[model samples]
Target: MHKKKDNVFITGHRHPDTDSIASAIAYAHLKQELGVPAVACRLGGLNDETAYLLERFNLDKPVFLKDARASLDEIEMDQPITISLNASIKDAMDLIARNNRSLAVVDDRQRLIGMVTISNLAHIAMGDTAHTIDLLKRTPVSNIVRAIDGELVYESKTFDFNGKTSIATIAESKLKYYELKNRLVIIGDDIESQCEAIRKGAAALVTVWTEKISEEVIQLAKEFDCTIIKSTHGSMNTSRYLLFAPNVREVMTTELVYFNRNEFVDEVGRKMLETRFRAYPVVDDHDRLFGFVSRYHILNSHSKKLILVDHNEASQSVEGIETAEVLEIIDHHRIGDLSTNKPIYFRNEIIGSTASIITKMYQEHEIEIPKNIAAILLSALVSDTLNLKSPTTTPQDHIIAKKLEDISGLDRFEFAQEMYEATSNFKNKSYQEIINQDIKKFYLSNQEVMVSQVVIYHFEELDTIIDAFENEMDLFVERYNLDLLVVVFTSVVDNGSIVLASGKLENAVREAFPGEDRSFLENVVSRKNQIIPRLSTAISKYVG
Candidate 1:
């Protein structure tokens, strides 16, 4: 009874900061309050600062999502109305008709066995006359009785008949003309003839039309060790019902083409073409039934609805953002090359943090900002704006931070310092781990460039790992075949960045800023406002 429900996933960019995470969580709350089902998601693992904030607030972390690709799990596939292996073919057919499905998944012990279709049942039903009797041989006497509305006059609890079937239509003189040895004989209400057939070594005797056999005939059948079943159905109806008495396992297609719930719809769509089956069962890794997917479901596939926060670049977004429909974008960074097929609600500003934009939206929508949520938003604002010290901090960011601070009852500068200190523990972390903590890629002027940023209160902690940073940059450039790899070390005290460059753009970096081993740019703390545009122009001029 648990049906798959589609919830819109709201997430932020890779290497998400406190602002990115808080914005996603807050916006998901807003949407749900507006009667829209939504889930907060995180594209990357939580940073130390954000993790500290979440623990302080006792909030459940967002579910980690690797990509936004529309998969079969997101689509409304047919319900898994599975049939048991012991169920009759007639029951399978009825289930299919009632559920408006082409086939029914056969399961045994809660695991997938096979599938049965209407065509499979039809092929067995309309086959040779003897095939029906052959199939019904393995059927239990109880099943045959239920199929044809019969009752067992005399038989053990585990009675079964797997012998030939013959109707006693001919005269008692012609009973020898047909083989009755070890065979089941369907006879009418001829008491003398029934006794004669039972005497001729019949394995079972089926009396149709509520026939009453005399006590002498019953005694003779017991002497011959024969089974007796009485039914109200006529001869033809009894035979047809006997055809459906066999278990569904005997007719289901065992060699199957199936899909998993996590498989992408586009990938499954291609696999569906290799076979002639119209529907394929969706199973788990342990081969348990999940649901059924059809070609028509793929044709009418629904793309995932997403709300992107913090960053907008496709490289920084989830893995399959192109496969999803972007409903809105709330960010404070310079927009990258993220384009949509349709127009969306895009709110981009030059504020210090994405949390500021989300905070303004809360007021616009008249939604109350909870105390814990306000603390997180204020923490993100202080972290991103660097306690109103960074060059990217606007007047609006300061105002929003003050307002959120009053609501959260926390001191802005002291909290900001603690937040920065919480994430600045780089002693044990490797150079690769430190630089990749907040990295974004860009495709500018036909060149693939990667820019990584790390924030700290002071620069003395990184003096030991400067060589390691350069080595990691070289390795990254070689591994990814990138045109250039840049690492910006932003310091809160200096209010500037120490830029490190490798690859083809090393000379471009020197030309942009003529300096010593590490190029120093004044008031260049923000990658969005200062570093990106400067590097974009330098790379474009150098490459062109």
Candidate 2:
């Protein structure tokens, strides 16, 4: 599986239409053929017409991303270097030295428990008094032998050191005065002191620099139930090194600050500023360790790269478009409010659909267009031009549609009629679904307005669902905080539309059309040319 953050996404605007989706899919396929790591994405849910076309083509729905802001997953992070909870303090120091890191930690069941730093290790080593080694009694006897490189002379049974420890360098007679019962005694090659310690109930006996153990001393230690360890080093070094033999869990820091991979960059940065830690661990949703993230990684993060296909306005685009880098834009709509910091490849035209421009690009690159691509492209052209009936349909659109028809082996008129019939069947749909199937939001005269359009073969289909439409329109207006909500029911055969207007702007809609209840427009079909501009003008005049 590829990392999603590394892949470039080609997508369309919010509430995408057939042309918006088709052009994005076709362009993404073309780029992938030319060896670019690109995938098709959508910012919003699919409309009825777009969903129908995708189902006919056997294409998976594009990846949906609600926001485009940079996340922690996009930045490079440090690898996790962890040690077990039973590891020695010296082992933690060695690992940190080999990896060139400031700290090493301990874990249990894949969850971090503590951290072992240089300062903590030193405090444990030098901070010990005569009683500090008493804590080592809780540690395993095998760990002490390994830490000091010692061998058991008489007893090799597994056990823990749970007694006081002392250096028996005093007079052999004075050793009796000091309590040695259940205590660990460290002495140098002094056979008298070794025998004295084992006879007084010492838990373990460390004989420094001794290669051979006397048979009497071994027998005495066995009788006292004491473990006898023979060290290769002298007394001072053995005692000092024994402190490091305990587990690192005894010294690690349990309190820590960390982050997750899905957190936003800005929020994490704000949290990082509250502490002085050089780096922090990153975890997944299940609290499993992922890696480490540092301040440098956050400052040098990369932005998501994108190629817009149909629209460019911020209000019509994705939620976080301002944070992404727009490498190119291929649109056929009016240039709305969009700008960039540097020069980019921008192609905007007055053509009917974006599919026409993409088809021309395929010809210019001399790449063979696939049959599925041609079929979807032609469907988009027919839908946007309304079967060559809308005023926006140009000669170029006609020629390209005919060429695509030959490649797809499908008749244009039959396919268009079938697609419109399949998408316009509202028998099982709710009134809200019908109105929001292909809705667009716009701003006119500082007021938010919504325009929804649905095409049908005839007006008779509306007689069954007209009351439901008006009822849902009232709720839609209140829910969306819209000043006006207009649903344009256009007839494919008559080439005219009946406008249903509601909300606070009812007077503005009446001003736009003042005539009989069923007065039909002569040649008004395209919403871009005949509907939106006229409605904007009437609303402006009414508001003024």
Candidate 3:
């Protein structure tokens, strides 16, 4: 079943939830089943509840996403979404829908231009003013200047949305005035006042509104010898509108984050989660704008198709659900917003556990579930139904639980108890081991920083762990050669966390958190969910 990957596999929504976590793990397993390099990814930070669930199940969280668009320079971005912005927003939305989740990059003249995401257009419809100037930038100076018949004073007008046009440097003054600084001249206007204005250093001369020809005016022009011209837009329109019309290079977002034409879906997932921008512009290192990405792109992204189990509807399902190409939905919940590209083995009967539905699939295929997989599916059913306590539980859960208990050789009650205790003891480990364990890195402006977090059950552990964290951070920053560093502790049991971080990055942490009433936590209850957010918030406040 193995095949060389021609593209990346994507799954889920921007802000991932537990169902997203479980489904992604399952879907990735499905890909491995086919010998494909499939990965499940999420767009936003993990919530506290999700961390607890993942730890309880002993499942690795789905990687975080940077944007749907890929960054090709890095190996991770090699298969990034490469959609162009030359098309309509509807086209962009359609692409996002069809691709599960994809990175958006805008291009023109075979060069990466600016980024535009589905949300960017949505925000435009919502009356956001940020995109107005950027939209018109689609037409380059080459296009507009092609309409003009003037001397190429500044042959170097290749800049895109440049901000410096308002005040050209003295070195560039030659484009406007002549050497020796004599007053410029002009002619061919019926109004003497117009002629007078032209004579007063009028760098340009044009025949006004009609082609009012005059031999005398021509003679004055020959004497003064300044440039003369005629424009199709008419003298009034041209004189008033031309100069104010600046190129996109004057206002385009030059300092942009972008991806190469190729990038992988799995690799960039963790990156998208670490940063705050809902959509990072995809571009080459030369700084051209690509397409755009949004939170929805993650949900709808798909490089590898999936047959979903357990849940439907974006809210209850995993994050970046849209980013996955849904094959079939086998669930007990009511179907919500999910759309499939084609028909699949979808089974949404009124049942208890997805494990039940999956068990049926195995029976129909006559495929045996491996012992470990059976153990996991059984665990998923137990977590979702709470041992048949929830109203949604069905007889199938009880049956599967019994079968899985027999096959996996473990008592369900005993296993659940042991797992719960492990979840509670998940904290108070080595600070560096915890931080450098699963955390990722990104640069702000230009400074590199490392962020790590752990959630704990007991609040007192925060005080006990700070000194250890500080020592580890010093070594971490130096070892990673980072500019700043931070470690956070969250007590999901208390819905808050205490952060221990380098003084250099402390201000950044404060700005992200907003409220001043921060304290060192005794410990956090869910490190994955609670601590990472606070750490990221601090990073956003202080970093670029």
- Best first by lDDT, ranked: 1, 2, 3
**Candidate 3 per-residue C-alpha lDDT over 1-544 given as tens digits, one digit per residue, 9 for 90 to 100:** 3332233444443344333445556655655565656666655565544576556556677766554333333222223465444344444445666774534454554355544444454454454334443443443433333333332222221233321111111232322442211222122334453344335434334443435535554455455443344435544454333332333233233345544434555555566776676565555545454345444564445454444444555543444455555665666555656676667766776665555566556656556666655666666555444444444556766776788788767788776555434453435455555664334343444556555545445566555556666787778777777777766554434545666666467677666544553464432323323444555566665565
Report RMSD (Å) for each prediction in the order shown: 2.8, 3.8, 20.2
Give TM-scores for every candidate, taking all chains together and pairing residue i with residue i.
Answer: 0.91, 0.85, 0.35
Residues 1-544, candidate 1: write the lDDT tens digits: 2223467889998888788899999888888878778889998888777888999987779989877878888888887888888887777777877886755455555678888888788888778867776777787776777777788887633344554678888564756677787777888888877887878877778898754767887788777787888977999988777777788877888888888888988999999888877788998778788788889999998778899999888888998899888999998887677899999999999888988998898889999888898998898887777677777899998789888988888888787777777777686677777767787888878888888888887888778878877998899899889998888888877778799999988877776666887856777777877777878888789988
Cα lDDT over the full model 2: 0.80
- Using lDDT as the measure, name the better of candidate 1 and candidate 3: 1
lDDT per residue (tens digit) for residues 322-403 in model 2: 9888888998887878888789999998888999999998988888889889999999898888888889889999899989
User: Which regions of candidate 2 fall more than 4 Å away from where they truly are?
Assistant: 1-5, 102-137, 141-158, 163-238, 406-409, 456-460, 491-495, 513-523
Q: Once model 3 is optimally superposed onto the true structure by TM-score, how far is the C-alpha of residue 452 displaced, in angstroms?
A: 26
Q: Residue 263: error of model 2 in Å?
A: 1.3
Model 1, position 218, has a per-residue lDDT of: 77
- Which RMSD does model 3 reach against the true structure? 20.2
Off by over 4 Å in 3: 1-20, 34-37, 42-59, 65-310, 314-325, 340-342, 421-544
